[model samples]
Target chain A: MFVTLWRMITFGFQNFFRNIWLSLITVLIVVLNLFLMSLVSGLNVVGQQTLTAVRQKVDLSVYFIPTTSEQRVDQIRQELLRKPEVQSIRLITRAEHLQELKKSAVDKGLVDAAIDALGDNPLGAGLVITSKTLDGYGAIANTLKDPKYQSIIEDTGNNFQTNQTVISRLSLIVNRVQVATLWLTLLFAVIAILMVFNTIRVAIYSQREEIGIMKLVGASDAFVRGPFVITSLLYGLVASILVTAVLVPILSLTNPFFAQFFAGYDINVLGYVREHLWTILGLEVAVGCGLSVISSLFAIGRYLRV
Target chain B: MVTFEHVTKTYQRRNVGLEDVSVNIEAGEFVSIVGQSGSGKTTFAKLIIAEEKADKGHITIGGWNITHIKHHEIPTLRRQIGVVFQDFKLLPKKTLFENVAFALEVAGERATRIKSVVPQVLKIVGLEQKMDRYPDQVSGGEQQRVVIARALVHRPKLLVADEPTGNLDSINAQEIIALLKKINEFGTTVVLVTHNREIVNMLHKRVITLDHGHVIADQQAGKYLL
Candidate 1:
């Protein structure tokens, strides 16, 4: 049995190499299918990683009323930090804000413009509220605008009209991208399956007479189907290696650019994408093997009657 | 020994294959079943191999009932009966040696057994010199000889050849008949199904003639009688 199986394996490889053009065509189709799946799945990973990092950068800045006493502002900061949603809070005084502005200015021209336009450093002391979770930021942002804080606070930066619209639109675009990628992945998966199905069907058609003759010569059913099964397995194995070899470098090349955009948060955006390497490979092989086996089995069962 | 009792086969539910066929051949007898097209000769050959099951009646080869044989059991049954078809049935991609050893491989014969039996059979078919050649590389007669060698590896009790020489020239046809006769001389029952009237006439062996699914004649030392 071992020798026969070994001979069958060798025969399968011999047949594959003997007809190089057909084998190349089959491998090309499988590679294209697996490549599309890997690309879609890989991009989805990066997109989600970027979105989560963006959400972690959210913070609410509560500016104190200009006339409020320093002690009153400090008392409001202490009260706000006690809230369950607040992960951390820091108070920025007007003088500190002016100092930060001067440090951010690249030249004397901007600093002189800022001093003349404002006349008297008009910036107020504000409380910066960082939330533990992005989902809870909206509720915390709303708390800063409550009537109870009207005596101590003037306005919250988180409630600015432009900032609200920009954040919501970015979230919306990310969600749309996710939905679109999912649909595209599903569509490409179906096409890949059909492509493999037709390839295997054509293979079985080409081998129909040979299989029939083998059956007539007292070859068992397993013996007759053995070569084709091994053929599919070889196709899947090769396609998976090709996909993984190509995808890893592609992911690595794009990681740095993605990382720079997500620098404000603690997340290693690229690390998340790289961690799923085995999963991507597993999915590719599973898809490749599954499509080939099912297609060949169904086609052979229908065509090879004997 | 092979026996077909009241065996009937229908193809496509309308076309007749074989109808109410009954016959018996003892061990070591070389019998020729003769018929023209649509006369159930090929159908009778397929029945014995369990390729097509009989609609009614029993088929016993070497005392094993094959009428209700399971699909999985067909392989073991086939291993016991050597079959040669009209097409020669040699795998075109395989060499002559691999073609003959394929039967033994399917039967799970040991590598040593295959290595031992294959060349011996090839020598018997007189294609030992051409064993390395492929089916396309060899002549039709040589390919048919390879198939006969493949059939003999099992040492089956019954050898059923359905027009084994249909595609060969007269010289090759005679050689094949002689080879079958020689095999019968060694005590293997041989059943040759053919439309070659001349070869059947010359054999002077037992003949079973079928016409439209019914046996028209059963005679010892039968001639090519229509």
Candidate 2:
């Protein structure tokens, strides 16, 4: 049995090299198949990361008129903080608010001159409120509309308005893209699988006479099929390695671009791949080997009757 | 060594391969099956090796009933019977040595034994010098010789040569027939299926003549009667 198995693998490699062009074509097909799949998978991961980051950055701020006393503002902060849904409430005092705007201003001289002209800070103090979820923000919005705090809180729906709109639109776009890509990936996978299957079928059909001769020479079905399976396995392994080699450099090159787009978010796809190297390779190999091997088996089956 | 009783086979539905053929080839006999094209000469050889299952009836080879031989068992049956085709059927990519050794390798023969045996078999067909050459690198006769070498590796009890000389010139055909005769002399049953009138007349062996899927004549020490 060991001898037979060893011969099968040896013959498989022998045959693979024999038809160099065909072997190369098959391997490239496998690489293309895997590359497309991994590319879409990486895109999905990045999309999810961007969406989550945007959602986390969405916060509601309740500004008080400059006349509201510190005690009154702190009281409203404490009251909002007591709500279980509110994750955090930080007080942005008028002085602190002025300092923030001035630091962020592109023209520091203009901002300093304006501050001197005003003499007293005109910026309003507010409580920046965050929630565990986007839905929790809705509850917080309702909580602020209570009649008791109406005197101190100037606007309930003012600060989070544009961000809420931006986030909802962004979420919609990302979700649509994810759905489309998932479908596109599935469609591409099916087409590629069929193409591989047909390629193998053609290869086997060309060798149909050889298969018949092998059987007549007393080779069992396993003996004949063993070599083909090994050849396909090599195709899968080589393609997976090539895809990884291709993907690592590609994702690495794209890292800078992704970082610029999703600023402060972890968009390092290469890092993601390395972190899940085993799973990624495992899945790639499984798909590659699984696809080619199955294709080869089905293709060679028609000729094994002898 | 081979028995066919009321065997019938057809292709699709209309094309008949063999029709109610009943024949028994004794052990160690040199029998030539002669017929024109589409006369079921190849079908007789295919039946013995279980390459094609009969649509009806029974077949036995060396006392084993193979009328309905299971697909898996076909290999074991074929290993015991050598078959040579007119096309040579050598793997084009494989060298002469690899081609001959393939038979044994598929049978799970050890590498050491294969290394020793393949050359001996190739030597029998006077192809030992060209053993490393691929099939396409050699002449048609040499390729057919390699097929004969492969068939001989198992020391099979029955050797079926279906149009082994069909692609060969007179000289090469004579050489292949001579080789088959030599193999038969070594106590292996040789079933030569061909349409060569001159070769058949020369063999003067037991001949089964087929026509349109039916056996029209069986002659002991037969000449090319067709």
Choose the strongest candidate by DockQ: 2
Q: List model 2 lDDT by residue over B95-198, tens digit each.
A: 88998888888888888999998888888899889999998899988888899999999899999999999999999999999999999999999999999999
- Each candidate's chain A: what TM-score? 0.74, 0.80
lDDT of 1 by residue, A208-236 (tens): 88888877777777777777788888888
Stretches of model 1 off by over 4 angstroms after superposition: A1-8, A53-59, A65-96, A103-122, A125-136, A157-162, A248-279, A303-305
lDDT of 1 by residue, B37-137 (tens): 99999999998888889999899999999999987788788888888877888887788998898888888888898888899999999998999898999
Q: CA lDDT of A146 in candidate 1? A: 75
Model 2 chain A lowest lDDT segment of ten: A155-164
Name the best candidate (by TM-score): 2
| Model 1: CAPRI class | medium
Residue A90's C-alpha lDDT in candidate 1?
A: 81
Which residue pairs collide in model 1, if any?
none
Which pairs clash inside model 2?
none
